[model samples]
Target: MDHRLSPAATARFILLLAIVLFLGGCRFLPWRSSPAPRPGHGLQDGKTAGHGEEPRIVFEEPDLPQPAGEVATPARKRACGSPPPPGRRLPQVAIIIDDMGYHRRIGGQLLNLDMELTFSFLPGAPFTPELEEHAYQLGRDILVHLPMEAKDPKWDPGPGKLLLSYSPERLRTTVRKDLAAVPHAIGANNHMGSRFTEDRRAMRTVLGELKKRDFFFIDSYTTAASTGMEEAAALGMKTGRRNVFLDNVHSRDKICNQIGQLIALAEKRGWAIGIGHPNQATLEALTRCRKRLLRQVRVVGVHNLVR
Candidate 1:
């Protein structure tokens, strides 16, 4: 049926329709809308507080030791050179050949040696990068042999040497430059630093720079009073000292004896790092006796011994 509403009733009807539309649109209004409750909120029916709570622990009786017959005993200690008592264990001995990159012949001779030798190259030397890359490629560790002022002025380590007179900034700059000159060098060791190494301030500066670069330091122990270790330790840098100088005497017999001394030290201390030059006697002795030396100890790299 066609029904017409009066003006007042039409106005009322329109107002009612508008109110319904407004209520329907309220779902999209942020203020009137309510977000769904998140999972694990105990709003869901049939869920209770602490529904997944773990059960209270109950104490148990203490475990008793097994019978002597069921327990395993450690093996007995065997005598030295007695096949290691069936398990392999050897003392670690690290050999480092310092003063490299000076003469190609000596450096090449050292490279030819079968034993794994760490080559410490002097920065700014003619063959520094060549020898460093050669050693690195041969599965040997490379070290930057940093020059420092020696106790005797007559002994010149090399150009751009860090001297005691230089300020800390100059010393750090020199060390950084030297390190950059040697390629593939993972660490650095002082070269003839009997005087400079003794200066705690200077050594600290050098070691601080090395530590910043995440490199290690090996003190050649040129002098008994060297402070490289002390400074390095203060900076939390990985460090090691030369336990034996293989070529201190630079004679076949003396070097052989020194090698023996190195083995003895390695045995006593569980590890030792020996530093030697590429002297004829040193290389000769090392080449001749490396096989025999391997039998007594495991010759490793300087980094292995340090870290």
Candidate 2:
């Protein structure tokens, strides 16, 4: 029956109305949108309840953030080895440590070694970003360990492997995305691209993209039939192919022996390139052969060896 509210009641009504309007306005404010989640640098278990003897973690396609603007340039100039002073005639060797991002502990050990080793990082591996930055800061030559389809269907080449099925445009965009995943990569080398590298057309498409970004390529030489070097030559891009695989046998003795072979080749040819993976045995072998490596040949960054 009351015609109007009491003073206290009217004041409360006005206060509530003001609060509602303030709350509603806050939603449309600039800071209201949350930033996207960034990819984590650690391995998370995607385990199922009952699996095999060991719980296997299946890697999924990484949802790395697509950069907003044009791809950022490398933070620092690419690291290169200084030329020998006045041609003393010491043989030059460039040793590249591949498969770096998956095993951080061993990778750290390998990086800490007092050597001018080059590191090639897998783009979407769990520890890729952190390890790659460390390598860059240490003045090491860095490369995107670009994955490409292996010949065998059973051997998955991990995520981001460029396949023959990809259109030329898709290959180009995929190369950009892979390079973006590993910042400060001055170049790229294949991971396990036995099949893709053999396809001259696919290699040409992928390499053209790399050339546009002023990046070099090194064929892993996974297949003897690979046309990587030839395709790169056609594009007139600076390129090289692996001459020696250091850890194929995964033994310290074998690796050191391979290092010796690499040194011998460099001595014979005046320059050579060798690729190794991040392994304890490889690290141990490198540590063991450090004195020999320095004495027998001049160890340089892969950039120096790439023509």
Candidate 3:
């Protein structure tokens, strides 16, 4: 109990105790170094604690408000400047019966088909006016099936000749004569203009005349390189082209196949125009398929469907 230490030894012991207190009080002292894993999450460094692998953290973004006056209005009112009626859908099938003035029996058969058809009459036929009037009276549209020169000389459309060699004035005169021949015609489509339709100048002249008369143009599309559409668009005319020819083969089976193709095109494009002659076979096939076709899509006049 009476043991005492030297002054130097006591001083050394006191210095060691002071050093330990200083280390404990220091806030910035370096401790065991680690990366400080994100707040309360566990590291998935090849450890299997749960049934499956640990769920990864997904950072969520905050919601942002749209700028002032940048909202989109409903499209119906903006383009036409008025809202369209709710229940109306565009017609799908526009059936046009071309070359209607030559044969009375075929024309009569078309009349008895009992569907809304657009009849295009050949100019200067003996029964042009009569057939046009009959078609109109029977609630069908009338179109002037203008005769233009085709690639083959043997296949003539009809009276009026729309040759490619004619000057602009001559072409205009011929078109006027053709239009005058077929009275009460609402629109015009080429009869057989595979050669003439490819001529841009002739097509422009025809389209210009049609535009002046305020008629729609329907390109028959006999050839793949048709400039009729481009010319009509340039002339600012309401126009469309035939998507299907129902009687290209003049057989019942082939015509039915073409009709099926027409239906498919209508389904794909929302509207399709089909042109056909008033042949007996075509008429019979159309009559047989009219009811079933109408159930799937509306069959309307060509003018009613095209804009």
Candidate 4:
């Protein structure tokens, strides 16, 4: 070490101090923890891969973070000024697409929608089982579309038709077969049973079996005089009916109009179920109007709508 400081020694010491100060002031290195990985929507609960096909990447939307100290209320009650009745809550809409499985392309399109729409498959349809599996894996409700006696003989209820003339034993066997064909069918609805659905004896047989199996019934309302719902209630079975048909006209614009009607009905009542077919127009209408429908009321699965 030098006893006396020289100009060169002093200058070197100053340079070393300046270098240390500069590094400290830079602050470029991160000293905080890493941010939490934002999970994708629909799989926030970590139950996707094991379930249905990864919810067909419809709208790759991320869940919006809720504000602090805030909780979500049911959409139906959000606009309520006064507290609803003890048993009453928000308005909900459950849309069911009937006549699936017959047309593979349209049925697949309906299944891809992540809205949890119910799919009703016609028994004996070529691809009923395959479509049923798809609906089940995706966590959507499935219903076996049972055919019954129609008013006109020319209407033709196709194969597996449940005729009114069949004995009680035959009717029970036929109903069982229809329910078994679908993988996860929780209920059954008539495809076309104007004459049969009105027959009290016939409906009792069908409803009795459904009660044992713990299934529900949805009155398609093919005819105004049908007694399916009343019979199911007598048997202590869960049941509901279609409030509207979205595609009786088979036009996109018409279907959208029908959806508007459904929303209006849902708002008036606590809940409503709209039945549609698996057609191009119906799918297009649903895809376009979902944003608006979801805003006004909660669009739920059919099972949720059952009374």
Candidate 5:
């Protein structure tokens, strides 16, 4: 209340004013921490977004239909390959187990299924050579799972991948090396070419190399924007596009449903190709569905479907 205060009082007032001012100014600071997102809010599916971070986009091709619900599996796994009833011309469906060579045990199990499942080997995977040889011996159709740049950089397609920035020569060289890594490969398919396959020029370069070797191309069709199937056809190369992705969900029920979907698609279109991974769920699903599959349609090699 006095005009002037003692030093102690003045010091106390100054300190209080300073503390208030500091607290008030914090709201204007550029680095103010954001409130943590409530659980089940903000970032989802274990994805993060920070400065300069592009939001992730997960693409599901239109052809890949999600299952309505969990499919019921039988207690006893019925034998899969019962020769199609005589005199019935069943539609052909090709099942390609992609991402092979990495999972030796699962791949071996898949090979034993007697479904004539095609095996697509990753060129740089450690078990590729041995598994490729084994698949060849088993008379399974082989494909080079050619790595290519995915739309999401977070998804690594593995080594020796063809990129959109590559020169034609570089793309050709990389493709050749990738194909060489897998012996007995009658053709090649995109492992994850969401981005690379969308670039027509780049795809032409990659497909051109495959054309020279007389190898077919199967577009995994990771993206709807992909020009791989179109470009390959324009080059007069035998080509097929995947109709269904069998195990994107990795549930045995889901995969069995997808296989059912694949067979239905083939019956409608005369032929259909379903691509899956060397996953245990997929192997089990195929084994479980074997009899129903053989009875419904002819399971052929992927090469047979590519045209």
Candidate 6:
């Protein structure tokens, strides 16, 4: 108990104690990361529904496919919405732009055109109010492009489409509701009524309602079998039939060519009606063909051609 260590031995003992202290103080590095993920499972991307609840799996949506083509310019954007500047009737021609309200830029571009054209809006669309207001501000003639059943078995005519399955009363109610949706709507046209427009009974029910409201009808003539115009006339409601589909092919060349034909027809018959969509191709065609259209015949609103 009283034995003293030699100086060298004591020095060696102290060095050993320092080495132990330094080794014991050092642990894992500060920059060390967590454990590697287990195979086939991640660190739960989802949270528990509540306390003591199992976590639910969260899925990230796959990217949707892009549309086939991008429309740089709308197919038609004719300067629209008025009659020939007073005293210039000049064998009127009216262009009607259908399928409005779905696309914002196209609709606005169509409105921007300085020509007098009609805009037919789709009721119940998300942009219905905005489109109606813009068209209204520009004093454009607004028409409700009423959706109707087509001959195709699988084609979806979209919301508010008229079905042959509807009874007369049901049809009337639906028509009224649609017409009311677009304030200042002077008339309506069928969206795709190849089958419904051909049924005389259905046309009568539809025409009868239009007659009651003093609204005009424009038969899109989606099919040659359509009797929509005849029934409207039978009911004594003012009506018009599509003379030419301006952009059936949805190309600038085809649409402009169609517009040329429309002008010639207008000169011959005193009036012509052309229907087109709010597309880049149609817009380009109409814009390019503006001067020729003005010289060949007067471009008037759809209402001017109703008679």
How far is 217's C-alpha from truth in model 5 (Å)? 0.6
Q: Please provide the root mean square deviation of candidate 6 (C-alpha atoms, Å).
A: 15.6
Residues 1-307, model 1: lDDT tens digits: 7699989999999999999999999878778344543432211121222343311211111121121222222122111123233355788988888867655666787897888788888776656677778888898988988888876665566655799999889998998898888858888898777788889988988888889888999987777678898789788989988776777666986777777777766766688888787667887888777777877788888889885
Give candidates' CA RMSD values in order.
26.9, 15.5, 28.7, 19.8, 9.8, 15.6
Instruction: Arrange candidates, best lDDT first.
Output: 5, 2, 4, 6, 1, 3
Candidate 4 C-alpha lDDT tens digits along 1-307: 7598789999999999999998998787765564432332222222223333332211111121222222222344333224335665557888888766566667888899868688888787666778889999998888888878777655555557799899999999998887877858899888778789999999999889888878899988777678998888888889988777777776987787777777767766677788888767988998887666666667788878777
What tens digits encode model 6's per-residue C-alpha lDDT throughout 1-307? 8699999999999999999987777764464455533321221222223454322211111121111221122224323223346666678888999877665666688888989989998776656789889889899888998878767644445567688999999999988887888877889998767778889998898778778778999987777677888888888888888877777676898877778667656756688788888778988988887876786577788888775
**Which ten-residue region of model 2 has the weakest summed lDDT?**
70-79
lDDT of 5 by residue, 1-307 (tens): 7688899999999999999999999888888366554432221233334453422323222233332332223323322335556897988988888877656677777888877889898787767888899988999899998888877666666666788888888888888898889969999999777788899989988898889889999988877788988999999999988877888886998788777777666756688888888766887898888878888788899888877
**Candidate 2: residue 138 lDDT (0-100):** 99
Q: Give the TM-scores of the predictions, in the order they appear.
A: 0.71, 0.73, 0.69, 0.71, 0.73, 0.70
Q: Which pairs clash (backbone N, Cα, C closer than 3 Å) in model 1?
A: none
lDDT digits (tens) for residues 1-307 of candidate 3: 8678789989999999999999878867777565543421221131222353222211111121222222223222121132224565633788888777655666777876767778888785655677787887787888888777677665554467688888999999999998987768778988778788889988999888888889988887776677876788778887888776777676976776667667666655687788887667888888877766665567888886656
lDDT of 6 at 6: 91
lDDT value, residue 225 of candidate 5: 80
Q: After best superposition, candidate 4 residue 203: deviation in angstroms?
A: 0.4
Best by lDDT: 5
Per-residue error for 170 in candidate 3, Å, reads 1.4
If both were scored by TM-score, which would come out higher, candidate 1 or candidate 2? 2
Model 6 lowest lDDT segment of ten: 58-67
Weakest 10 consecutive residues of candidate 1 by summed lDDT: 55-64
In terms of lDDT, the poorest run of 10 residues in model 4 is: 56-65
At residue 257, candidate 2 shows an lDDT of 71
As for lDDT, the candidate ahead, 2 or 4, is: 2
